[model samples]
Target: MTTLDKRQRVANPTYEPQPYSVTGYPTFRSFYPYYLGEHAHPVCLVGTTISLSVFVRALLAVLPLLSPAKQFAALRFGTQGWKSVGKLLLGGLLQGYVWAWIGHFFFERNKPATFKHPFYSLLGDLTLWKEVATLKRRP
Candidate 1:
């Protein structure tokens, strides 16, 4: 039997970064192609999703605790609850924000994908989370 050539044995790559000319556009629609390019690395997407999930959970938890009706009336008007909620929101925001920041700052600083492509960023986040779940279930 004839042997296959070594060059032909190599598997084709699945992902390639888009060229700068295609990715450099300023509009959200235009930037989405580049944003999709950045998400080829699953870890970045997963980290962002996890961070956002944690932030939302924290916010929901704090809402009841911070509500004026949930606490004593006299202390409610001027007290720590509002401050607590503000801190919680800030902390949650930082968690999600930092993940995207790290990806932009460290990995793909040239394109800065999330700045103009919030929708695709969110799509990447959810898609990565689903991938993680599927992988975890594999035998």
Candidate 2:
């Protein structure tokens, strides 16, 4: 497999919770682990997976439109049509928003790192989704 950058490799690294201080906001490195921990619930994982998949598909669709070369490549690959993908993405976004709000308002009841540390949040979402899937398969 191709090697990842250091940031991506440790995208979901564990956190070392220090005392809440009056300094600036925690950096991405400090927030990612906490984000992962918050997504331990199976529902959260499922919601995040659905959301991210839609987000990525939407991004792919939009990217081609912005660049002719990419548009041609997408057509060649039979992935040029994007209206359905756009609708799916919208639905996914709504679902993700609901899940995130639930986590913030009821479960975690705290700020989510996705607002500040998007990359790590995505990584944590995938990791948690995998864990939840594996656990479900076990007897």
lDDT of each: 0.53, 0.57
lDDT of 2 at 9: 51
Put down candidate 2 lDDT per residue, 1-139, tens digits, no spaces: 2223332454343322333334634565555456655544435555676787777666666665667674445522134356656676778879887787687667655666677666766665666566445542110
lDDT (Cα, 0-100) at 80 in candidate 2: 39
Local error of candidate 1 at residue 107 (angstroms): 2.8
Q: Which stretches of candidate 2 lie over 4 Å from their true place?
A: 1-32, 40-42, 49-81, 136-139
Q: Could you say which candidate leads in TM-score?
A: 1
> In candidate 1, how many clashes are counted?
0
Cα distance off (Å), candidate 2, residue 93:
2.6
TM-score of each: 0.51, 0.49
